[model samples]
Target: MKEGIYYDCINDFLNKNRDIETKKLLLVAEYTNFELKKLESYSGEIIGAVVPFIVYNNEFFNKGIISCDLEEENNFLLIENLKEFSIEDSFFKKSKSLVVLVDGLSSYISDFLDNLFQNIPENTQVIGGGAGKMTFERDPVIFTKNQFCKDSAIIISLNKKLNLGIQNGWEYLEGPFLTTNSEKNILKTLNFKNAFEVYKQVVEKDSGKKFTDDNFFDIAKSYPLGIIKYDKEVIVRDPIFVDSDNNMVLVGDIPQNSTINILKGKEDNLIKSSGIATKKAMEQIDLNNENYCVVVFDCISRAIFLGDRFVEELEEMKKNINPSKNLFGALTLGEIANNGDEYITFYNKTCVTGILC
Candidate 1:
């Protein structure tokens, strides 16, 4: 496997690597600030998404494109409609890992992943992310070399299994609140009261910070909603903003009638959890085999919450891995990974890593 990061543009990178060896190329790049065009006479397939930032080695950046060449037998599928994606059973049978990238701004992902996880076998590991710009404006994020798309998802089936590490360090701040009136990703009413109003009452009292229109995301990142699932599991969901109806729009979906907790994070705990996640992945890696690739789907909200100390979170992950191996990933709008022997789902404000050997 080979990869490189370009700061200026992808056109120059495509021009430079026209003689690339593999047929599978992934272009994980920063949002639509760069110009793009199809390579004339190019025969290779390209798949990737636009993200807020790209993670490479020990550092992260906002203005760059990271292109990689896949080394295994892989199949790429583009789901223009997440609710109705189709594939034969042989597709998962032939794949050892599934890299799923979906539109971050869409509310259909939770249901989409639920159906997808049921179709795949236990031996198959899954990882990927929600693709969108930081500005939260609707635009094309997931794509092929020629197809710039929206309201879509791209599934890349790779023939290599993965060692996975997944963790989120958030403790309850309030809530045992009931999601009474919710639809898709919109939290309309919690416990039959206005969702945003209930959230504001708790968060303001806890942090002594008012939720202004401008600083909603900045404050909400530290205080997310946690939905309780079966087997003592809790999934985190980020409330990005409030809509005109005072509905809290979350990054991931929560069905109505679910129990939720308002979660809060400490800087130390969040950073340490990221390190623990990497350590778990490292533990699963074969010691004798020095060759492996690290791909992460970390939540973009974590970066905003950590602010200048976000480097500490990156350094924690870097500290556990072998310095010789490349640590590559994206600051996704949400994370995708399968839970231990349970099922796969979309997550918010968490870190999911895959060790491809």
Candidate 2:
């Protein structure tokens, strides 16, 4: 109904540098099979908000290159075929510094985003989120074409320098535990027994109630996965489903060879992270009086966990950011961010990762 906020950065890119129009602009939204079409539709809304601003501020870049890929389905994608159309290729070009906007769905984003630095330019930067869902099978309102069903994605790419960062406030809990057995992305065994059983052990040994099928939703909301990143930072990846066989837990992506940690989130934590992320990003540029456009990707789980607490998180952005700037994003399963040098960092269960140009 209302224009999203990301248009602020898109519009700024058009105005700041007179030469931006000469470069190629590509927009991509890498989402899961569940939200592909809906994300595409959101892209349409983004285009609607951005187009007029582009026309008004910087139409000189007569040639605008735009393409949207609903990233390949997890179980169905061929790694080789997926490699050919990389997330890096979506934005990086020779001598071109791109402005990338991303919205990740599920842990499958990691598979699609592995080896990000191989193709992206050194000057490239992005901002976006790990958006969540209304329901497993129902699509959000942004996409209405697929009977509001799940299984769709969206991506948008621009050519510019917009300071970007993703902020998630999941603190590490006990047990940087090991996976004794596994499948591809599914954990077949953690020491031994059903995956849920292993989690129950963690709860019993630690602080929480035992998880049962009737109370799966309770644990699902509070306990999430933490993947260790290159910087020794633990990235949160949400656990969506569990496979009873082989003791495997079907997470968005595998927690990898390292020990897995439990992560916890609170309303204050989400709001604080949002502020910290935005503040950290502002510090990157001329903070004193500079203007920036902000966009965000939030975990759907936070919405569920906070319920009444949710208002504070979103409200803080309005209070902290420059309101005129356009901002728009969805709740996703995972999030993608880069280390600020090269390579896209594929994270699970994190909050906002975005670019401010």
Predicted model with the maximum TM-score: 1
For each candidate, the alpha-carbon lDDT, in order, equals 0.82, 0.46
Q: Could you tell me the TM-score of candidate 1?
A: 0.94
lDDT, candidate 2, 1-357, per-residue tens: 112312223233334434322212222222321222433323222221011011111111111212222212101111222223545353344322332222233334455455545655666564433323334422231232223212223334444346665677877666667766655457665555456676767655655576655556556677776766666777665665554553434335565355677677666887777667656655566656444445555565666677766666666554556555444454445555665565666555555534444
- The weakest ten consecutive residues by lDDT in model 2 span 49-58
Error of 2 at 125 (Å): 1.6
The alpha-carbon lDDT assigned to residue 196 of candidate 2 equals 60
Q: Which stretches of candidate 2 lie above 4 Å from their native place? A: 1-91, 94-108, 129-132, 138-155, 192-194, 204-208, 246-251, 287-291
Candidate 1, which ten residues in sequence have the lowest lDDT sum? Answer: 1-10
Alpha-carbon error at 49 in model 1, in Å?
0.6
TM-score of each: 0.94, 0.66
